[model samples]
Target: MEIYRDSKLILEINDKDVNLQVFNEKISMPEFNNVCKLNPRVKITDFIALKKLLNLDSTEKTKIGELKEIYELDISKDEMVAYLKIYLTNSEIDRDVDKVKTDIISFLNSKNILEGINHELLNSDIPSCKKFVVATGKAPISGENAKLVYYKLSERKVKEGTDGNMDFYDVKLIDNVEKDDWIGEKIPPTLGINGKTLFGKIVEPKPGKDAQLKYEKKSVYENPENGNYVLRAKFAGAVKFDGKKIGVDNHLVIHGDVDYSTGNVDFDGYVTIKGTVADLFSVEATKDITIEGKMGIGAVKFIKSRDGSVSISGGVNGKNTTKISAKRDVYLKYVNETSVVAGGDIHISQYSMDSYLEGKKIILSPKNGRIIGGQVKADHKIITGSIGNKFEKKTVVNVKGFERVMIKHELDSIEIILKETIGKANKLKRQLEIFESNKSRLEEKALNTFRALIINYDNIMDEIARTNIKLDHLEDMLKTRGDGEIKIVNGVYPKTVLEIKNLQRKVNDLMSCSFYVKDNELHLYD
Candidate 1:
């Protein structure tokens, strides 16, 4: 059987015999014959025959020696890597590097390692008697997971002062969006590319995992233009995180102090100020308002909520400088010289010192809450831990039968205005009467002035009629009465005036009692 063949010689191995035939007598043929004799697998028994054949261009096969073993080829268990080892001596394997490479390729083909052959390394010099990594397998690429890509809103940059310094407080912390504005989109996962091994075995890749976009349907909706993965705002407002979902809220938030940086916030939504409001500034909102920081004297001209409530965690140190109003309720840590009016209730956690508080009900914390040296009025009831201090600060508490006093005061004021309107109308009528008497004898300009006077008279009469209707409505409200009370838990010291409805009780002695109206008179229950 033929073991190896080349252009110049043919090497054969028979039963216990090695043969070599040199068909061409070229300059390198003798060298090739010598290399063939040097193969350790074949021990030369007739070196003279091989030399005679190389010298004589003989094509006839001749026996030279017997065989031992062949070169070794190793493949990894996974068949991902392959290595070849030439076990012959260095001098025996010394030949043209190209021919060696050809022999290696032939061996690899026989061993079934046809893929990923390292041709570059094979093209260079290879060592003998040492394992050489001749092939490598390709690795599969993993797919990327799904992700969300948010659209860019405003840059959170601050304004530069005249000296070129950045105004840190002016940086925008909230992202605002208009109705139908795109917010973000989910990017789908991808399928990865496959790979192969040294044995040409196929490798499957891992597909990426998909994800859903989190959002609220009320404030955010899927954009029809880009399918369900894309999101858009449903209203014009601030963008915020509603729990775990991203949403657009009808609420404005001030992350820092509300000063020149955020000019007097006047939003038509819920407002939350994490910091203090500066002096002379005002905050007005259509919904609830919350102030996390303290309100100093003159800090704000007014903090008002048109249709919701107000809560101040750090209390008010207004010093009679700010007016706070809410349609529903007002919650405060403490009140110091501030005037607050709420249509629902005023809840104070601590002392209310020299502050004018008016609400449907005034509630102070029963633990240590106190009211000292201020007018407190509630339409329903007033509950406090203490009423007056030891020094007799003369605090006044009024529970006036479900806004009866408030309605009476409004009615009185409107009656006074009505009286003025009637008087103005009578005066205008007398002036018009004098003009009508002289109109026939007056010139064109005089007649025009007379006509204007008559119209003014009619307008004043209409004003009087409207004022009378408003007064009548307030008077009717005063007639619709309800129960009212004032309860003092700890003590009502001397000089404290407690009133219920039209009755009054002066507490000259320290007493803890509930004052209510009974039998058309004020009664105290201890």
Candidate 2:
């Protein structure tokens, strides 16, 4: 430390401590000549000396007392500031005008000011607050209250009892009130991350640790304009942040663009897409999603929920589901879902028999697209956009591009041809003789296969006969009608009838031409 006459620090140091190889001999007290820039590490002697110099009780007055006497000193009752003179000489109470105001209001309230006042934003275009008990200007106040009231009212409401402009509003100029004795005011609470001040209690965030509150989450104490009021976050270790951390459980907003390409993001929280989510990403969350920008080109969007799913605007062929199945709704611009239920009403815009739809009730959009597959079962109602169907229930379909769907038979010729192909393919030893050339059982097996083939052929012949009878009936009906139009029901198109008949006839003809085979028979069914 140093002391100066004209302009220099009157330096003082323990001679022994000052000169030593291990001491590093590197220390300067800015208070030298009335200037003391701080060093992070204060030597033990410095700490005691400085404390004594600034403490409420100092024995042999230090230069600080001399400095205060030489320079007009108006240090507020801030022990912290007194502890370090650097700030005391530079900053003034006027700089904390809002704090002064809050102290006065709080003091007035505790002391029972004429009337109670609700604190709000200090600069609002329209008054966000009003004095219902007394007309404006009736209470003892000044121009600042007039100017500050406007803001208090215009700013949005904060958690139950916090002021807007600052933890405390400016009180340096309030008439008939003490600036330092507000009912619940204390030294302006220490401002930390997000400018949050703390000094009382801790609250469990709604979503628990890291839960982001949509609104200001702190609870404030509002008292009648009287005693001191102070706001402080007592917990020193709690991490405070800036801007807003959004999420169902916890949300985050990146000021810059985000590039996320994880296999899946599963959270028991809410997610927000401020920038484009470039690819089809999967997310499983307990709550909802809000997409601020369009999902980039060529990406599919899918959301999974355990409770309920909500998307501000969404997509097609893409499905969003939730385990809470009931009361879940999917709103989209252009999309398809077999079922949607809101308050128990299920709605389907377009659906195919092959595509399954199951719900408590359904409402179909007036618009309808082609449906090639699945079952539609709803307990309530079904609406339609436009009915496009082949009128046949075709399974295993993707109903994508082909307009005017039709029932295309999926032939499983394996079962039908199995018996015939295998039997005709079996080995034969009949020419040698039943007893000498072949084993008795093997001969029987061959004859049995051939006989079964004959029966199968006969069955085809019968089918042909039946088909002809039907054809004749159709012809007779056409003749009977003599000019009326034919009605097709259940997709029994004329072509379908023709296909069956043609296939049946061919089978009959093939059966008519018998054949015998040797070893290595084909077991088509197996």
Candidate 3:
């Protein structure tokens, strides 16, 4: 029989179950409760089911006061988490909260979910009618792979100096290693830790992989200073790394030109090139470098030695594009439009035309070796066939060499700068004088302009004073040191500038002569 009837819903109670039918989709809870309030025997044991049926156009039945059927427990597929859902109950039903909590705990314990359980949720006043995360498991972490650390050379192709010149000699294509130098060290991998699950099962973490250290056993040795895996060089050589292996190369020989096929030659030890070095290709070494083949009318990029000498059997036609630097002497057959810097003497079999040469002493074949249209500097003496050509091509010979020439150039640059600075200061001073009487009557922009002129003039004056002091110092240095001599075996033509210390004399008439400094005077003798 129907106990409560409304326009949208009907509720009936029987011995087996309580039935509910929702005629309308929108039904109120107060309407159902009003019917229950009139009959004390009718009670809501499952408020969740009754509330769900009130908003649906269907019929559903549920047992009164059946607490066990209202609970739901679920475990995720991975078993890493567990969820518990409890349906709503009514105050009118006789029930025990602790008994329900005890049943849930017992059920979780039966499933072996003791680890990572949320105890606070089980002990607190848990809100019903919704699912809650009751337990969580930890995830396994991955270990980092092993790595190698070692000394690495700079990868920059050109290093710029403070003087705004590119230092090609400083670039190292191969990393140079000394005896007992550290090559690299292999760091061991870490052992991974195990994880846990909601069921107290062990989850293994991923282990790191070890990387193999490949090297030549004869050229490299394991260091025993500490209990670490470190490799060191057995002798001095260049470091060679070929993706899978590493070793030290003492002597390297190139059978062909240093072109696209060979790239660049950079070795720690001696290097010998059987053929010519192609244009835009560089060869650098710590020891001596020898180029046996003739340079085939092309410019060589650069050739450098850190602690040894350089020798080119074939002549070099650099075309103003080549540079050779060596710590010791340099021997060349003939050079044109090239720049050579040597710590010791430079010996040339033929002539050097339109090339920059700097060394302790520059010597050429006295019979026919000529220097034309270029700057040549030597600290000791310059022995050449001729100073300049008969056509009066400009050729500058500095007997006092590198330091003196650099100082003179710096001083000349400073003089030009001083002249410009003084001129600007004078112009600004005149502009400031014009605005002196009308300072207060000027506009904001005009006043700013007047103030800027005064500041710029003061700054220029300060710069001029500093430059004068520097000029005095350089002039003193130039006067005290100019003792080298120049011996021209052939003839010194016009447009040839001879510099001894700081004194410069221009050659006008063609004359075979030798110039020397005595008693602060440059004397020329035939």
Candidate 4:
């Protein structure tokens, strides 16, 4: 037993087979088989305890059957890490732990798994019999991108009143900014971190991209501090952000009423009035005009930009003396006893009383959009909730273009003139014929009258011919004009006149209908 304990068996693993060296001590085959069972890759099919039973005296190296090499070391495609797996086979040889460890380390070094090695897992008991995770790799963390934080603007509309008025105080009419006010800030991008793989390969992360700040001239300034950018206003005015650029327009602000003391204001940029535009006062702007208070009697307001639109938060009480014109669209809370002309569309939120409005299109509010006691002319369509009052004070709605109306009027005038001229020409022709027939029986004065009558008749005939030609041309033009329509959502009162092109219809009773031109006549449809 001492000899058996003092002697050791040498094991070697090669590419094809495992070999063992037996010392000159009595060896128990059962003990060797038990040790072989520790390696999953080694198994014994037949065991004869020859050394213990026969007491063998020879000490020689013997060859064991092939180890089968069923398992392999797996390396990831990214060369990040490595793993080892072992499989059972028919062999009776105890595996050498030191030799297996050296082989695993050599394989990992060949695949470049130089970092994050799990040595304890590699040296664990019966490591070859189980799957072993030998290495792990780190992944890089990317940095955040830059962003723009803008100061948002207010988005509130005018509030409606119970007394058929609009509350202008609820609307945010201006986004005023003082000089050196912070408009926006640029959140800078952070630097990226470097990373490494289990194969000792260096990974470079992509750095965050930078963006520049854009601003209008004399409106904003860019400030850079500690790798961060900020945008500040340069002058006191109305600030606006147009997606890519920030701008400020000089605004003329009137704190008090636009009365005789304020006179008339004509600005090239934006205008904001805190109080009412009193009677007979005029306000004009090349860009936008905002009135915080109500529009008084006889006030005049105009916006010149063909592309710019106007928004009137409060109502207008024109008292038959006010006039408003915009080259583009006009949005109003309410209008009373005024004349309005817009090159584009007109949107009236509330009621329009005794007002004359003309535009490409006229649209009234969905609720309480009433038009009473005046005329509305639109080139395309006139949409309203109600037209005319209960008493029927003669409201007129013309859906034809103004140019067509003027042309039709001209044609009528020409026809009247042509009738008068033709009648005069016929009378002169008869008189001249009578004078020629009695030429021999007339005195010197009568002969002179006959000669003068002949010339006068010829002149009248020429004039008649020219006038007839002009009338024909105007009639052709009237035939070529396009048609327009009027749509009343609620009702049209009696005595309300609806006209399209040259056709006109007078409402004798309340009717909710749509009026359009068909076959040169105004037709009403449900």
Q: Positional deviation of 178 in candidate 1, in angstroms?
A: 13
Q: Candidate 4: lDDT over CA atoms?
A: 0.69
Supply candidate 3's per-residue lDDT for 204: 84
Task: Please write out the lDDT profile of model 2 over residues 1-526, one tens digit for every residue.
Answer: 3321222223233332321111212224343322332221112344555444433344343332212111111212321111111122213334554654455355434433322232442221111112121101122211111011100112211121131111111111111112222212232212222211111122222121111121122422223232323322221111122122111123333232234644455664445545533445554555444344433212344444444433323223433221112234433223343232332323322333333444433334332323334434333223332222344333221111111111111122333444454343332223222322233456677777655654454455445444454444333323311111111111221111111101111111101111111121211110
Q: Which stretches of candidate 4 lie over 4 Å from their true place?
A: 1-77, 80-136, 156-173, 225-227, 295-297, 301-307, 378-382, 398-487, 498-506, 513-526
Q: Sort the candidates on lDDT, descending order.
A: 1, 3, 4, 2
Candidate 3 C-alpha lDDT tens digits along 258-331: 88999988887878777888898899999778777765325768999997778787778998999999997787
Candidate 4: residue 86 lDDT (0-100): 58
Q: Name the top lDDT candidate.
A: 1
Candidate 1: tens digits of C-alpha lDDT, residues 17-42: 88887776542655764665555566
Task: Report the number of the highest-TM-score candidate.
Answer: 4
Best-first order by TM-score: 4, 1, 3, 2
Cα lDDT of all candidates, in order?
Answer: 0.75, 0.29, 0.74, 0.69
- The alpha-carbon RMSD values of the candidates against the true structure, listed in the order shown, are 28.1, 39.0, 26.6, 27.1
Ten contiguous residues with the weakest lDDT in model 3 = 163-172
- Model 4 per-residue lDDT tens digits across residues 21-57: 5666565767776656645555333234334322454
